[model samples]
Target: MNPELKLVAARQGGVFSRAQAMAVGYTPEQIRERLTGGRWERIRHGQYAERADLSALDAWEQHIVRHRRAVHAAMNSMRPGSAVVSHHSALVLQGIPVWQVDLAEVQLTRTSGRGEVKAGVRHHQGRLSPADTTRVDGLTTTTIARAVVESAARTSFEAAVVSADAALRRPEVSAEDFRRLLAVTECWPGSPAIRSVLAFAVPLAESAGESRLRVLMRNEGLPPPVLQAAFNDAAGFVGRVDFYFPDHNTVVEFDGLKKYADGSREALIREKLREDRLRALGLEVVRVTWADLLQPARTATHIRQAFDRARRTRLAG
Candidate 1:
């Protein structure tokens, strides 16, 4: 690869157009040879990326990386300022994690044209005022608030809440920002769902797993638990819990892989000790993992059993 072309590709998320390769002293035949040799992979029509970059990512991460490169490719091929990245695509560019949202097609909002889907790109025809649009990674994109609302309008409630919760955690985004966008889009389709997401989204959620767990609790008819509640004992600060059910005297902790990413025995022992201390305070503890979230009914039953145990212990005391 030419040095100039590598620079260009680096600036565009490791994607380069065919014309860019040609300008960087590569012939059409050579480009084809590189693609065939697996040195370069095609992202979209006439868009190519280094095979090494794609192969370096894990399967799940590769999807997002490919979609991001595709977004850059799609935007580069379009007329400048003609459209802004919107919806899930905008969230992607803004670096907010999305859950269960389709990324097969890059979504854009045309400033002045009818909506259409062409070549894996979905052009949305909607009003995008200056206030609602911003630049992200050198590409024009919808503001985080608008992206969240637009995304909520089109995706499942769980997916929407995940993105919304993540967005609210950003310093640039606030609950008020979402509310303002919600007010403006009140009559828009899926406004009711967006409203529900706004009402439920909290900044304290630190991971997508936690957000999904919250949605599951709501859908399973569990009473709302306090978020990130702090616990302490006479020794010192115990730890902050993910969810605390005050009335039930139980605490639910989301056990995602990141919690134990180090795979250290000492870390596990520390966590066990923390649970012991919480139990010493007469608080029943329940653990929720990604797998447990998948089995919502069983998870709810387990939580209920913990609540019953706490009640029984109190009675015995």
Candidate 2:
């Protein structure tokens, strides 16, 4: 590990391109030797990082690596032109939830094409304002807000709603940012549909998990579930519960069955312990599982009964 390469790797947070290494005075052979020695890990064709403490490819990292690859491919495949990664690619990069499936197409906007070009990418060619683009990790990308708008245009009202909600909740993204992005993309191909979906989803994205229980509860006319609610006491901030009704001191937790690895018996014991704590506080607790959520009619009945019981208890006291 030469000082120059170490400095470059540190500056890049242990990720650098072959070109970046060359610029920093490391030969391709040197890079290869380091990789063979287990001193560096190759992330992509040209991207390398430190071998130790490598982060696994979670959902977010998958999106970023895909976006980075697409951008690099686009740069290589196209003529000399600047293209900002747009639409769903931007949404994924911004950590907005659009769907769970793989996006086979990389999206981008440049000035030379009419509709789409390339096999894996859906490219939209049009004039783009400078403000519509920003540099993220040294690659051009649509601003977070524009990506949300573009994503809404490509999906259904429900999907768009989810994207908008996620976008609003993002700390770096704001309504003002969306407004500015909207102003720039309004005259572009999919503006009208984009505008409609953006309006729909941004207000509804309060919860983090995309659980069917959430959808079932919403469809059944329950009040919107507060997301990731935390409990605080003598111990600095107790565990964060899934949903809580502060006014009634009633908590509803959505336990994904898949998370219960040891089996239902152990899960049952854990739930009893959690319930006992809440009961000690004089709080009512309701537990819902994936099965209950799938059966919406039964789920609604359970919720209504719980609400009724809580009301009776409070009134009687």
Candidate 3:
């Protein structure tokens, strides 16, 4: 809490190099005491993060706090231009969402093959143009578009779709941006995985759950559904459903965590009425939740049944 140390921490995103602590008039014993008392947490060899700084963050934010500290620590220890953060670490710096990626290692990239700067470091050797790299969080990182594709290439198809969907939904990253970045990486190794994800990624997927649902449908060979489809009655706009099949008059809704985690009674009542309106319009509605997504086969069966029912109703009418 010293004035100089506070200023130093502010300059470094609530992290301070050990030398900064010393130069700011803190003795070695003082630093040891702070660490012993949990006032400061060591973020790798030469960096420290204040306990107070991370107290308000959730689990993921806390991990990011540490991740950034690791980035800076490595940057400070290495020779200039030795490595630039990329892949998952770069995605984190660019504020892009990554699905099912290991966060334990600090990710860095060098155009020339080189050994790591520290322990727990993941090093990638790839050609990076200025268009593909940008500075974020005071460190060199891959641009959002590049990071999304690169990280996606290193993950499973489902995870890749989730990350790509998130990138597509970002206001700063347009469909064109994705295309440009994909074009830049077309000749790179392991790009086919990401190319496949980009081919199917939809911006209408507003959450990880919705992205997962879309991937789930695709993997099962189900007919693609129209996203954010609206249902209206004689009164007015009734509701905008998540996914709709015009071919079968079926509506598929993805019930995300927010639908239940923080859902109020008013929201629940409105949701029920919305469903009623859709059903009244003779559309077969199938709601897919996280649980249903986990049981992909079961969810597919439910959707298939809904499509069949809608077809039968259409024939009868």
**Model number with the top lDDT:** 1
Q: What TM-score does structure 2 among the candidates reach?
A: 0.63
User: Please, what are the lDDT tens digits per residue for candidate 1 over residues 187-224?
Assistant: 99888998999999999999999999999999999999
Clashes of each: 0, 3, 0
TM-score of each: 0.96, 0.63, 0.91
- Per-residue CA lDDT of model 2 for 1-317, tens digit only, reads 66787776554434667787789788879888989999877655567766654267666566556555555544444555646678777666556666643465677887665676556767776566776777665456777777777776666555566667777777877778777767777786677877775554534334434444565667788777666676665534446677666666677777655567667787778678767766666667778875675588887777777777777888998
RMSD per model, one decimal: 1.3, 6.3, 2.3
The residue-level lDDT of candidate 3 at 43 comes to 73
- Model 2: residues >4 Å from true position, as ranges? 1-68, 94-98, 182-216, 225-241, 245-249, 256-275, 280-283, 287-301
- Per-residue lDDT for 109-144 in model 3, tens only? 886666454588877777788878887766777877
Alpha-carbon local distance difference test for all models: 0.91, 0.66, 0.81
> What is the clash count of model 1?
0
Q: What's model 1's overall lDDT? A: 0.91
